[model samples]
Target chain A: MKQNRTMVVIFLTPALLLFFAIFVYPIARTVMMSLFSVENVTSSVSEWTFTGFKNYADLAQTSLFRKSMWNIFRIWAVGGLVVMSLALLFAVILNSGIRFKKFFRAVIYLPNIISAVALATMWLQYVYAPRWGFLTDFFSWLGLEDLAATQWTAAGNKFWALTFAYCFGMVGYHMLIFSSGIEKIPHEFYEASSIDGASKPRQFTNITLPLLKGVVKTNITMWTITSVGFFVWSQLFSTVTTDLDTITPMVYLYLQVFSTGNTVMEREAGLGAAVGVTLGLLVVLVFVLTNLLIREDEIEY
Target chain B: MSTAKREALYRSRQLNWRKEARLLPGYALLILWVIFTTILIGWVAAASLSTTRAIYRGEVFDFAKNGLNFGNYVKGWNSQNVSVFFMNSLGYASVSTVLLVLVAAPAAYVLSRFKFFLNHPIQNGFVVAMGVPVVMIILPLFAVVTQLQLLKQTYTIRLLMVVLYVGINVPYTTIFLLSFFSNLPRSYEEAAAIDGCPPMRTFWKIMLPLAQPGIVTVSIFNFINIWNEYFMSLIFANQDATRPVAVGLYSMINSMKYTGDWAGMFASVMILFMPTFILYLFLSEKIIAGVTGAGVKG
Candidate 1:
């Protein structure tokens, strides 16, 4: 399969050139853009005023940015907790030799194939609609009048409601990942345990969970990345361009760059770039930490 | 066999009432979740065929009374421009998938099969690129596109979106196909070499066809992604003529607030999802494999 130098160059040039033009260049430009105070991201560089760390300092001072940081952290931490547990539970149940497993798996994974914009809109108008919405009806039927009375889309509860819907769409995708990981474990392990007269719960704890450590780590890393990219659902949930209730770092970055409505007094592409830099660093940080902590080499399974 | 052995065998089979009962809770939970997941999409389908008043009044499932109102589809397609967006998405997704495969497959072949100086770093770069969020580069990328004067030029913007789609997907597609090419046996190439074929010819005539399944899987993944991509198109192809289904549907929903044609909006949503639904119906296995395979191995 070995090829000579000329063939290698011919084969690799297209992808390398594309990688540089689209990804490497933009990322490099983003980092550099963050260091300069530019009027418009599209403006010429001669008009740029060099600002060293001032954008980052301004971001530190901005309360909305602080709120956005907190919001994204919650999404990563809180939403991560919910999605991981639910996806794992579903994966385990389905992998435990259930009937109609394929049907259930497909139904659960259906949302993942649909556009986020469509899913978010469906959640907003159908499930979270003020009056005869599914949640309101269900809660009222359960006789939890107080819960039914609360507006799910209101400023206070919109974040949690958005998180729940997002997690609902996401769980199936992660569940499929877990299913594949669980499927890889040889059936003999379970059979041997059962023959040894071990309880099902005991077998799951001792064998299934340990074997799935790598999958769990993968799921966590993925959850972190998706939460960091949370934008569409936030935009769909909020009526305004930049609502504090659902503003993630992505939305904040968008508002800064686009400067729509009364949100941004001036176009601060530098601050927007700074936000990008921060989020980018956060992803790299999580990735490195996960790799260090997970220690894939330590587990044979 | 003794009665004790028979009893042990019966116990191991998990056919007893108590063992079956143990699975009941799990089944119940799964059934509840499945119902919850399907109901929203199902209701949307029904709503798309009902009157807007019926939907507003929560009679979406009351088909016996409200019956089917087919005008919503006509309205969405013609008046609301759903057809334009649908065609735009189909074109973008198809072209992008082809471009992605064409660009990524050869690089993957080289990276997986050849001994190159920057092989490790190149592969590592793609892996790292996957972890970085798109929002990181998007703002600056927007700047670049604007600087290129592609804004408001519908065809050029559409082309920009296609190029961006291919670029964003190149890393994952390469990595996905890399594993496929690596797992391929070396004998295929050796045979082609012995037959007096050049390496590029061998790749084009032999290896490429052999890797059809992997290429198909990667292409389907790209197609679905580019079709469903929102943020990028919302920025790049915001023009009426160039908007894809995702952005088009978003703006349609926003306008529907004033128009009050809720059923038409739902119809647009149906139009938006129909292609993917049809794809999923026929190619569920491929979609699932492409999605979960990329996640698991990568």
Candidate 2:
């Protein structure tokens, strides 16, 4: 349909304007801000000193930043592996003509609908709390006294506990994605394989795994994005603003830009911007790398 | 029976038998997962109805002895400001979803249907923007909002958050609707044109109604997102009067340290979770479709 220029502009104006204001301007400002040292994000540009790459170099030298970088990498890699495999397994099961498919899918995906704050609080106070926590009580009831006595929320175990909770909350979401992908695979492929007398495991290896490569890529990209933006859960699990055990890059960025009083190390907007930029780049890199590495031509059903 | 038919029936029956026997392991694992997830949420529900004393005594599932206390809900709602936070969350999410659909639909239609010179670039811009996480833009956005003095005024800050919600969601919403618009048959628009309707009028009067399922799906997704959105709201709408349920609930948990109102805290979580939980119970298909569609299609 040929459209008038005025009508075209009218149709597009609100979206374009909002996009520029909310996304484009802020992102551009962030890039510029990262090159200069500013005390706080709200400071005037005139107060910014040209710090060049000092902020990035400083970040490299800072042990906390290094620790956070390692923490995020572990979350992305370790959590990605666990969530993806479980999601795939569940998706495969649900697609195998199982009973209660709807009930099971909903149960798995229930955590995705709840607010992150509430889920994290539930995990913190209910599941991991030393006193009367679910794990402690369950293990003790199971007669595993040594396991029951373990302090899940203590600094030694807090990071893993946080990752475990985060992974639990995420599995349902990724499972849904995998289930949808599996649903699209025609039953004929499985039927033919079964007719050929291939074992169930063999059929999965031959048909299911290859077919799910694309969905796996999507899951990995999504996991990368979430892993990089990890914040609220970290805050809930950490004792202080700058806890080394639970802090991710996003938490570090928040502290650098916004923390005040005793929580404040120093308000360094430039460094925070650098952190944001690095995190953004890390996500993009993963996306591109995953795409490159997993270049299997998707089979169109 | 004919020999060929008898053999075919036997083969099919054998296949069914093998499938059933092989699925036992899968069933076991799935049941374990279902029980684990369900019990966690169920335990929370039970605790929300019990007193803090019973909860401390590890009587979470012991309803008869603990005596279900409905007062926790009343106290949480009235005394703890959950009602206020719930209302704020509802208002923001609904308004943002409406505004998002309003702005995104027309743009998506134009981008998908018409061939403007800049169409491809604009489309790619949105797709690229999807990869840019909110954390990247947030600090600068906060700075800008603060400089405008929007932080001091509750209403303006709320409005700003709605705007932010709409803006951040536009890329996904538009891209989502783009596929819907493109997949739609052009016959309706052609018929509308023959009947003397203008293009803009056609979009509003005819095209939109045809895409109702997609519109509803995307809007539900937007509603769930903005309702649970914490990070941006924590910065922009941090005031007690304006905080959404996500931030509100976080602060409530922190305050439990002083008050020791653990039951009230659980009740507050239930209140915060109730809307999305109910929505999920009723419209799970839409939620699943909206979420997975974004991932697989992209």
Candidate 3:
């Protein structure tokens, strides 16, 4: 085929130009901005004071920033475990010759399509409501009246509630990934294992787990991306703008750069950039680490 | 009938009681999950049609005692400015999704077809861009947009919003359609070319329409994403008339303390999500396949 350079240029220019404007330029500037002390988000590059690494140092010392970091780390670690296990379990079950697989899969993935704000509202307003909440009603019906009276929105409990809701919404996506991977595995592996009298659980460990190594890495990377961008859930779950219990780094960044929330008094835009840089670094680091750890041993069928 | 489905149907016809019994626990777990999902959305639906008093009184489901009321939707739509929010999102989502396809498809087609030096690098760049968080580039984007003063008026902000939405999703859309275009048999273009059609004409007349299924799938996906987008709109759109539903709903909820219209609030949430929810209802299988197939770049 003859190469049409003009045609390629014409087609690619729009997307390439927009990508540079939207992604490339901003990313480059953000890296620069994180190295400087700036007053506001709208401040010109001319107004920036060169303060190499100080913004990061300030964030490191700042209690709220540290707290937000800790909060997101927990979300990544603990929520990762809960989401992965449930997603894998559901995926295995759904792939195991179930009836109405599409219906169940759709229902599970329903929350992912809806607005996060709306989903969070449902959890905050109804499911976690103290009076007449779903948990309360269920517990009371089961004769656990004292357990039914628990205040889910209280300081101690809000984080778990938030994590639980977030995990529930996320399980569908990871499950679909796992299920696809599971489906791609040769049925003969399972059939032969069963013929050898291996139980289902043993088959899952020996065949399914080993085969899903790439899919597992994909899930973890996707999970990491979502966890790092955990903003809406934290904001919806928080009672205040600066709710220490629920504030992730994203909320912290929003407060520092955009909102006049009480969390940051100085409102240093540089600090926000630093937070972004830290998060971007974390994503890259995790990608690198996952790649290094889960080196794909390609197995051709 | 397909062999797989036929085989499964045949198996299902026979009373595989032992196999069914073995899978009882899986069925129970799936049923429990589906039931929870049903009740979660069901309660919200009931609350949307009930009065605040009924909701607070724990009788939203007691329809006989408290008849279903639709005044909440009316109030939410008319008085709470949800109408503006809904229209903004509808406009933004529809326009951006179309433009996204238009912009992404050509690029994807070219990248998939051509043997250019920049092909792999460009594709890799877009893939990397997918993982780049919004917070990373937001400050500079804000600075540049504000410096250009695009946020001054309602229409400009709306235009800016659409442009931003399209820009954000261009990478994912391109990557998704890249694979779709690659998988397309090149024989279509070759046939058209041999029939005296130019290369570009072949793409427009022959290939683009062939890629319609992928385009529609990704367009729906983009539509839902733009409709539910929050952080960017919250920052950029700043005004009442220009705010999309996600930001609009957030503001409404934030002000619920003073308004105290819990029923109206729930109604607005329904309005926010109903479009995407309805889309999923009719197109879940397509949307799910889109996600698991080539939707989210690994």
Most DockQ-accurate candidate:
3
Model 1 spans with C-alpha error above 4 angstroms: A1-3, A261-263, A297-301, B1-19
lDDT of each residue in A125-174, candidate 3, tens digit only: 88998876999999999999888999998999999899999999999999
Candidate 3 residue spans exceeding 4 A from truth: A1-3, A261-264, B1-9
Q: Against the hidden reference, what TM-scores do the models get?
A: 0.94, 0.95, 0.97
Global lDDT of model 3: 0.91
TM-score of 3: 0.97
lDDT (Cα, tens digit) per residue for candidate 2, span A52-151 = 9988998998888899999999888898889998988999999988777988888889999899988998888888878878899999999999999999
Q: Residues B1-298, candidate 1, lDDT per residue (tens digit)?
A: 9999998988776656775688898999999997887788898889989988887787888988988888888878897677888899999999999999889999999999987679999999998888878877887688778888888677898889889999999999999999999989999989988989999999999998999999998888889989999888888887888989999988888888678888888888888888888888888889889877753562
Per candidate, the number of residue pairs that clash is 0, 0, 0
Enumerate residue pairs that collide in model 2. none
Q: Candidate 2: where are CA atoms >4 Å away? A: A1-3, B1-18
For model 2, how does the per-residue alpha-carbon lDDT over B76-157 read when each residue is reduced to its tens digit? 7887677888899999999999999999999999998887899999999998888788778998898888899999988898
By TM-score, the best candidate is 3
lDDT of 3 by residue, B1-298 (tens): 9999999999888878888898899999999999999999999999999988998899898988888888888887887678888999999999999999989999999999999799999999999999999989999999999999999999899999988999999999999999999999988887887899989888888889999999989999999989989889989999999998899889798787457888888888888878999999999988998888775533
Local distance difference test, each candidate: 0.86, 0.87, 0.91
TM-score of 1: 0.94
**Candidate 3, residue B219: CA error in Å?**
0.6
